[model samples]
Target: MGIGQGSATCGSRTTCGSLDVKLRLFSSIRKYYLFSKDTAQVAFFVRYMSSQGPKEELLGLLPLSGQTRGEDIANAVQKCLEDNKIDLNKIVSIATDGARSMTGKNKGATTILQSKINHEILTFHCIIHQEALCAQTFPAEIVEVMNLVIKIVNRILSKALYHR
Candidate 1:
């Protein structure tokens, strides 16, 4: 991995490879993906920067036979990390859907991982969920316009001439 000697803006000018610089670089090195659990599986993906820019890889997935509470999810995550020989300290950001079990104030997976890692891990709610919420708020006029457009497109596409 190319470790570019990055700089950090502190109260005073720091030299290259300083603690601040190393911390900043380390934090930006990789992203942790904390996916939601709907069934009985818990999984996470790893997104890292490379010569080709950001690429995501599936770390691992573990099945849970019991309850899917925050504690259970946290344990499964821990096992996945251990099985994959991944260090928790490298996790910079955790991305998950906004479920109570995933984002609960006291016992969510994010909170549990933060506590175990003892780092101020950044948390991000899934953008798809946010977009869905925003979609629900679209004005009636805009929805009607979109419906009309969809109908027109469907009608056109259904025609034999357009099928070609």
Candidate 2:
């Protein structure tokens, strides 16, 4: 069946139907290694099928100050889920950018989260990241053109007036 058109509300007690509710969590972490300091951040998003239809929402964007390990990412995801009152049992899968911290067999965030839950959950690398990885193999001429386009876009976006 085609997905119905409507936005789902996610509150302390979301009213989304319980049956066949498949929750998919997508996470991506970005680490910045500067000369003076290091910083890392993670963004969490959730997709689910509600009674009305399918819906998606951003759960949180949190920073990891010290170390961006699997445990730390798992803890941040747990906190975000708990804060949103989302039951871990509802989650059917978790997708990430395929970073070692997220996909490691022993100490990855997905592994740790799966250990916390009673049921099996699917884990996969996000397709967007995979596409980006593939793009890296493009011819140098195409890459140069893409980079030039990006520079032009950045130049336009950097202007305050362009935001309006």
Task: Write candidate 1's Cα lDDT for 90-111 as tens digits.
Answer: 7888888788998998999889
Candidate 2 Cα outliers beyond 4 Å, as residue runs:
1-39, 141-164
In candidate 2, residue 21 scores what lDDT?
A: 44
Residue 49 of model 1, lDDT score: 92
> Runs in model 1 with CA error above 4 Å?
1-39, 146-164
Worst 10 residues of 2 by lDDT: 20-29
Q: Which ten residues in a row have the lowest lDDT in candidate 1?
A: 8-17
Would you estimate the TM-scores of all the predictions? Answer: 0.62, 0.62
- How far out, in Å, is residue 27 in model 2? 31
Per-residue CA lDDT of candidate 2, range 49-159, in tens? 899999998878877868999999999898888988988777799999999999999999999999999899999889999989999899999999999999999988887
